[model samples]
Target: MCSRYVGFILLVWFPGALHAQSAARHCPAPALVGGYFVPVKETYSHDFQLTYACENTYKPAVEGWWATSVCQDGTWSHTPQCIDEKGCFPPTIANGKYTHASDGWYEEESVIRITCDKGYEHKNNLATAKCANGTWSSLPTCEQSIKTCSMPPKVPHAVIVHQGYLELFPEDSKVHYECKDGYRMEGSDKNPIVCLAGTWTEYPTCSKVTVRGDHTSTERGTQPGSGGGGGSRPDSGHVSVEVGTGRGHSTSSGPGTQPGSGGYPSTSDTRPIMIPIKDCGTWPLVPNGVVVVQDRMFLKFTCNAFYTQVGPEDVVCYNDGSWSQIPICKDAFCVMVPGYYTYGLRLSENQFIKEGELTYIPCEWNDYSVAVRCTDRRITHTSCCRSYDHQWKRCSIVRENFLPVGSLIKK
Candidate 1:
């Protein structure tokens, strides 16, 4: 009976001792690159966990800046590492792909070219992107390209000059128009309507012409006859005649006879006639302009600062109840051409300069600049020279003299 009890106790004690030995087993401190671990020790027992953090510009290989690992059975559950944070992942773009196939990470300042799929183009016409310090610059987006414009709107009393059977017009295409008979174009005949992107510019208008002599007036008169029945034949005397102007006619009537015996010619007689005159209402509105003179039969218009009058400045109202001609105000700003530079400053393309304003254009010589003025949509004074004294030499001179730099070009 004593031997059996000793064997049972030995079996339970052996199992407990094995468990303690296993628990005492330890793992060496893990080595991390570009990082350090917290609560560091020479060795760690089983189930012991340690936290690690990476240095600046470096990230843990696991997930975040900090990570954890455990010592299990004399071995670490995970090996910690820190990698460069200045690298970028592959960019995912819709309706676009990289010009060159690349699957690896992109380093800082690396450029990548992108190509949009068919029927699409890069936004703002940009086709490349650069990785800047772990983050990519603004990437170009794929958008549907506008290549053509639909049929242009029709203008009253005007027809397209040379339009063919085609329905769509390519971008930047221009179409001319001609006014029909009895009508005149209100805008400039040289400037044609243009197609821009997917739309057409404003079409020109044709105004009708009012013909003269459409209204008329008439008057009646009578000459004396040889008969003498003065007092009694006052109502029936003389030959009456009628005359008219503008679409009127003439008429005549025979003389009257006396009551007793032979008839006698009557005295002259005259009758007054009245006619209504045609009147034109208020003056027509002028865009970008104002009416300087407004009268019952006359009107005058003046354009704004940057606009020009396209027609006559004054108009007259005729007897047909219509004005002679209505004027329009057109844009008169100067457009900056390519390679336009002035006074050490480079002007942007298509820059608008208002009328009556001055612009200094750079000359062939670095020290010289040409003074040009915008007048009625035209650039005046295109000559340039190194000095005002040498203005006549080495430059295409104009009739008008150039203004001094101090007068126009401000510092």
Candidate 2:
């Protein structure tokens, strides 16, 4: 069935018809034995030629199959047949995959789109390949796109873990930034800078760490240097600070030697203050139908399928390091009304109600019908009474379930 063996074939049995003309007067084009013919005509004159084409993913079995068939003296000179062309197999790529094509075949000049999996990136912009004459041309590969950050900048009185190495950093790399024995990060020791897009993020500053006998860190803004006992406070005159740029040197700024005065500590330079949930030593836990985004430092709520979100979508982190008001997820459908038989009850799944939808429920023993609608985040019920005379009257139900507006209902 391969198309490579395409050549002419001769038959010795039809020797007389090689030069003989047909007995019929009109030489309509004969039907092809195999494959299909193009430019179909209602009537064919003598010596008319018609072209034939094969189906998709197929080629002519013989070179003459691509040539025109002649209708001479009401007969075809030869019948054309088609065969399958050699196709390219699935390509092998690293860190990437090829998209599936229809019929699972790669024809000549077929372009295959390539995509890298998560945590990987395409090298250079060559994300595609073409099949040419049963061979793939210049197949591209996906390389590890992780970029490690260089060593962190030097900060006095602080101990950085996994420091300095040109090839150590990768995308989303995290490094521990803790202060030494008598020092702590400006705000907290757990705060670490992440590497993103081949660059290291901003790191926290180191300040003098004050520890009480109970092992709890003292609040920022407290002056350092203790006096009489382990629990005694430092003198108000001497301000504890770093001196001479060494890890072990400690000095105090005199009353006159404030900030801007010969490298003395400033009043603004104090211990790190605690932020709300960020200082809890762990990421905050989010409830169902919600997700936590560390980048914006907030919890975003999202409803499940067939449910509608009623509250805010974005909860942002404030400048004070505290989180803003978080929104809640709400159910989309209303609750089923009591003491009513609805039409097509068996067909419904009896799930949560959808907002802006109208449902009909008939009275169990009476002809009275009720129409319940979900709108404006609340459910409204309307009653239709079928009187003795067969007249219908619209009434309102006061004992119906009332869903409060702006209230979140978990599905």
Candidate 3:
């Protein structure tokens, strides 16, 4: 009858009993043993667990006491039993999240979303945070930035040189150019510069090289105009003279009708010849000016000196309309007859010549060339020009060129 009363109370509370014993150590509830561990502080799923009391007796769970009604309702028999619940310990994860990777293989990393700081920019790919061996890992990284620049272009009708070389930045750096001498620049008042991949922009230009040049000839017969007794000489009375010509005057004629008191021929029968004077053809062309005027002879002058039509070094048509002597640019400078200095280096207009610079006399330059000093104007394998300086006379001329001394005419 004692067990009957306990059985009645057990059935009323547990609804059923797994064991018919008056008390048992465990409930008959179904479970996967050793497969799962609830956290130390976690409770069994209430829906999956239950606590019960038999109407026959008062019982408590904390008192180390349990009633037969504690048996799993469906599995226990009509008899009551009591048992203690185990595996209610807390887990390592404190966030109340799940980490049930049933396969025993844990996720290597969680998808974590990341971001960069104020001045930095994102560098690596950012993902989201996910569940793993129970926690999260570090975030992605970020980096800084820089800038770059480009190269320059060329200009037109102007000559532009770096005055040095074309090199990358830190060497022949960025520089703009214009015409060397006579050219004028046309474009933006300001030059443009850029850096391409850290390189500089230095541009070059094209030059305008030209001059307005022309000539005309004036021929007037010798005649004494209304101007009393002094006038131009006639052609008939004049005798053509070529200085240094093996024999003085190349031609001769009768004396003029009215000979000037100076014992020179006059207008009535002599004619004044207007011969254009030029450099001995050995001098370089003047930089910005014409060397001499046309039809005006340089009858006399020293080498490389000032020229004034009336200067003592100059000679012009007299009142008798006849020149005193022959004229040439030789009077304006000490011209170095063009020739080779060394190694076939020929002379040019440049004032300074190096050992390797070329120097040669002017003439039809055949494949032929010879070695000589700076004063020889003859073109031959042995005669060369003197390449000297501004006045053109600084170089010394040789009196004995292949020919005997004074053999060649100073034409």
Q: lDDT tens string, model 3, 1-411?
A: 899999888878874454444333343443322222122222222223343342222222222333222234234332232222321111233212333433322333433333433223332112223333333432224432111111223343443346354322222334566655654443334344433222233333332334446642221222222111223223434532221111222222345323232222333334443332321211222211122323344533332211112224454543323344443322211233345443444556322111222333322332223333322332122333222221224333334323221222121
Q: Give the per-residue lDDT of model 1 (tens digit) for 1-411.
A: 999999899978798887787666798988777889889789988889989999998876555668898888888776666656876656888879985424346767777878887545555334666777676675667655343455555555678877785555656778888878866676665449776534455566665565549943211111112111111123444533222211332232454423222212222333222211113323455544555665544667776444568999887653223356678876665555544343343444333355677644445553355655666556565455443233434555453432232222111
Please, what is the TM-score per model? 0.24, 0.26, 0.16
Best by TM-score: 2
Badly placed stretches (over 4 Å) of model 1 are 1-53, 60-82, 99-104, 148-411
Clashing pairs in 2: 27-74, 148-169, 148-170, 149-169, 332-353, 333-353, 333-354, 334-353
| lDDT (C-alpha, whole model) for all candidates | 0.56, 0.49, 0.31
Model 1 poorest ten-residue lDDT run: 219-228
Query: Residue-wise lDDT of candidate 2 within 1-411, one digit each (tens)?
Result: 343333223335564666454443455654545468777776666677778877665665445336576766666665444545655657778768878755445777787878886545554324566776766764667755423344544444666676554534555767777777776567454357766533455556665555678685633322222221221234355643322222223344454543333322223333322222332222222232334334424445554333456657655542223345566444455555333433322223222345776644434333344455666546666545442222223555534456553243321
lDDT of 3: 0.31
* Candidate 3: stretches off by over 4 Å: 1-222, 225-312, 328-411
Better of 1 and 3 by lDDT: 1
